[model samples]
Target: MGGQENVDYSIVICTYNPDENVLKRCLQAVRQLNVANISTEVILVDNNSKVRVQDLPYIKEYTAGIPGLKQLFVVKQGLLYARLAAIAEAKGAQIVFFDDDNEPESEYLQELHRLNKQFPNVAAWGPGNVEVDFVDGVDDNIREVALQLFQHRTATTVGFAAIKDWQPCYPYGTGLCIKTDLCREYLQQVNQGRLTLTGRNGNKLSSGEDTQMIMLCISKGYAAGISPALRLTHIITAKRANRPYMNRLLYGTRSCYETCMVQVFPERKQMLESKLISGAKFSRQTLKKFLKTKWNRSPQKTFDLIQFIAAHASDYMALDKPLPGFVNKVLTSLKIV
Candidate 1:
């Protein structure tokens, strides 16, 4: 049921109120990518965007000549929902989840295909060269933090060993190339309202949907890894490097990680409860650090550190709030929420 389909690759680009200029760059990258003999399809999902993607002049200007380019509008708001909406429509045996900011190398598809053929158990694969292109004002520290903010990891993780580089990431969502059947299975989980974590939605800056899917595959003895040859550049903006944005990004990411943690480790319920009980103590320590570091080294660093600590506490305390999603429903069912 996978590669039996005619299409070789279905490139799914789901965007929500994206930067038009960067989105244009992404489309251009796709247009220029060397597909050669690959039967590729491009699916653009407008995730209820404020500015419809098709309305953008570049929609015609850039993607006009490209074949198999289709426009899809996902009424749902979340990034995961957008991908899920496109998955049902994808005819290709393989699907590559692309962000609007991604600029793939010419051989992106060729490289992924090469690796997939080399490793059949690989359910989801990504590009290793997928990285952040920081804007001007970014120094080394800020750039590092910004990369962390986006979960762009350079380390290549192929299987269960992939869990080590989980610095809030496994393989990034930018150029995630996955098998169709695995994508369908993940989509089914989404349809059943299982996974409580939703990926980035709008400008909220949260994540975890990617990791959950990969982890699910791993649980089933499938591998999630990277093809070093396939490359993609993530266009960065100054806003993502700012202190306030980092605070929100890290805070939301913390919630994402905790939610995914519960799903991936259902037996850790008692541990999560302990974290909830000690949340106040953690918050107090974070406040103390904030007070001391307010006048210390880089205010942004000091403040971001505080947010990192407080984010964990916040997720712990909010363990009671009912949300629309849950990862492992059986485990979460016993939650006191």
Candidate 2:
């Protein structure tokens, strides 16, 4: 046998009780891709969705419209688990992982394939996330600028030598693509039956799985890139995008950092500690720059940046003292209470 037949591309979407309308819009966007040289197959893996996606009205209508779109096996595991399962079943040479709640531009798949061919060694590619505010209108200008920045520094590494002015971000799970073979090979080593490569505790409680994969690829000499040509809008609900939810998300992100430290570089914990301190210093410097420049930017933007710096400082301080009491003190001082 010549192994699994290599198809053009396999798009894997993982969802956990997503709204039907959002899923419909995402599928509609996929259906609009104009690429013809490469065939596309969508693998919708229900991550044990409580809402029973199959019964959703819009899902039913959308599936009826998009005939021949591959409906692969569904997995009841968490997001990372379902992701791995879909990757394992994928028959395409290129595997694209998209979050269920995102709507990619019509050229998204075409751009990803173009970049993959341009950089043969690049193991992964991602697009900038355009935040879709359900309440407020879409900000296409900000999204366009973000995409431009993302493309300018397409293939870069993390750490000290990271590209200047380019915000270092792992492939966002929503609109990321990687070679199927590369994904399978790396996954085999890290995956411990039932546990995903990133090793989440289930789907809900698990975090940093995507970051873990990105670090693994970097460590293994695989280049990661981003294509401005490929764009996606991440749908944000009022409840999920509010202040309290953001704080909770930040806490989860902190836990992810701790997990990554333990898993990827337990021996280099001291080095990681140094990096955290350095990051805090950088944040302080950036804050000073903003204040000195009298940016007088949007209030929301200013507050967000300040909050990000504070979060990084808190992470650095908690590196040595990983205690609830210490965390509480930091939170109280920061007025996060």
Candidate 3:
């Protein structure tokens, strides 16, 4: 019932209490997409935001003016739940999931179309997320450049995986795309409560939902790639740049391991073994990098890297036993539940 002949693409954005200006800017970016053979439809899924998003000015503008744009469905659930709802309602052959806080460059949609055409077997694609520090009104070019260098140095880093096909160890939900039919089938499984978005009670910060989806697609013989050409600026507030948030981001990585083992892995023994080996390798590599860095580096950057590695180590240690309950407890204490 959701399919319609006119629609070629569906842009699904899941948001909860998103900054109004940022959300509007994101929509504006989508509006700037180069419209050609493919017609675009936007599906905005609101996850019970305290602020009424529909009341935002730009939403009204789009609802009133844009012709290529389709319906904006508002679902009052958590991010994953809202994403599932949007997937169900999407009418396009291809569905792109975007974060409300992200503003894409003009070539965003164009690159996806180009990549899909180049690799028809691909089930998923992602763009490099450039961070924009809003408080200072400055782009984190240093971070971006460092990230690029890191990705070039390693094959597994998320940024590197965006430019080529790699067995994605994790999924970055921001600016990721999947075929609509596959998304529907996957969400149906999730709705049946078989595969969950793991990490805890709907906290947006936790990892694994996107990674799990990509892994499922891979298991089904579908391909996934990162289109280096498509880029988006992920707006970052000062709060998100702080050490506490960095630590949470680290702990969040561990949740990815737990989720993979508990939700996707078929055999406990195999899963534990795989988790431990992968975790140990990641930890070792991280420690090696950490120790090699110069002491003259910025204190903030050093602390961030240290916390990130610590989180990875903690994640590896967690894999020593089955501790889904413990993972949930941590999420609960963080009020992520």
Candidate 4:
């Protein structure tokens, strides 16, 4: 199915087993969007949640008054599949992604319309002010680290251009806006089994689908960016505010980083695979940073750095063989696969 004629934007919300309160807030934010005279649609792609659609009565209440609202029940388990379903059913020239925890400002759609006009060539962009709202208070150390790591406030400038390989400015999943035509292009690659990042399937936090899509757009001579003008609040539950969960999320994202890069930019496979250091030197460097951070009482930063080093080490070790195989071996050893 292709996009419908004269539709401006399709806001897609993909959820599996979301907290009802959080989901309600997310829907309410969408409902409260100030679209003015713009034609829009709301698509809810339920990714096989335990709660049936018939049981989700509040969903209807929150989605009311949207121009074209459709709730789809997708049996596929992963975030990738759920989003794929939305792309097929979307009837808008532009598509915006909203996680179940994202709460957009009332002017989100209006700001997005302005951004589209400003950056006409940029295929993908997202909100830079991704503030985190913790339901339960967190410890000082964890709170500090979480805000720095989880928030997406890194865009110091507002411009669209080809992002370098090492630059960590790719628009994240929250509030990700992309052209519908680019989404159709991505859909073909995903359907052919070329892109495999499932992105937070159930409790498993492995992610990269968002980055993969942006990379695809970049590969096709398009730009991606982030703007502070657009804003959204990420609601973090108590379960995700602890040290253990934080470490897991960090590890999951880091583990999939290299694989996603290789998969998306196969032409640069050799260049990436060649940029590895010896295990002994890498270990010494990692140990030095670890001890220094430990002495400084920054365990979270230490763990975060270790994950990046481990990812590089995995690439270095797998230099002789296929990249994905070596990464998967490391994941299996760590029981992440």
After TM-score superposition, the amount by which residue 211's alpha carbon in candidate 4 deviates from its true location, in angstroms, is: 0.3
| Local lDDT at 162 for model 4 | 79
Error of 3 at 315 (Å): 6.6
Candidate 2 Cα misplacement greater than 4 A, ranges = 1-3, 65-68, 72-77, 129-131, 135-170, 193-207, 265-267, 273-321, 328-337
Q: For model 1, what is the alpha-carbon lDDT of residue 289?
A: 60
Error of 4 at 84 (Å): 0.8
Off by over 4 Å in 1: 1-4, 135-141, 151-169, 270-277, 303-307, 314-337
- Per-candidate TM-scores read 0.83, 0.71, 0.73, 0.87
**Candidate 1 lDDT, 111-143, residue by residue in tens:** 877777888887788776557776446666456
Global Cα lDDT for candidate 4 = 0.77
TM-score, model 2 to reference: 0.71
Residue 138's lDDT within candidate 1 is: 67
In candidate 2 the C-alpha lDDT for residue 53 amounts to: 72
153-271 per-residue lDDT for model 4 (tens digits): 64555756676463455588889999999899888888898877777776677567887888888888888888877889998888788776776676666656766767778776777
Model 3 quality (TM-score):
0.73
Sorting all predicted structures by lDDT, with the top scorer first, yields: 4, 1, 3, 2
Q: Candidate 3's residue-wise lDDT over 1-337, tens digit each?
A: 3765567788887777777667777778777777666788888777777766777666878545444454444544666677777787888888888787777788887778887887777788777445453543323534443333112212233332322222443236677788887887778778788676642223345655776676666656776766557677776555454534544554554445544544545544454455453534564555455454455455445445544544444444435443334433433543333
Clashing pairs in 3: 162-226
Alpha carbon lDDT of each predicted model: 0.70, 0.58, 0.61, 0.77
Q: Which scores higher on lDDT, 2 or 4?
A: 4
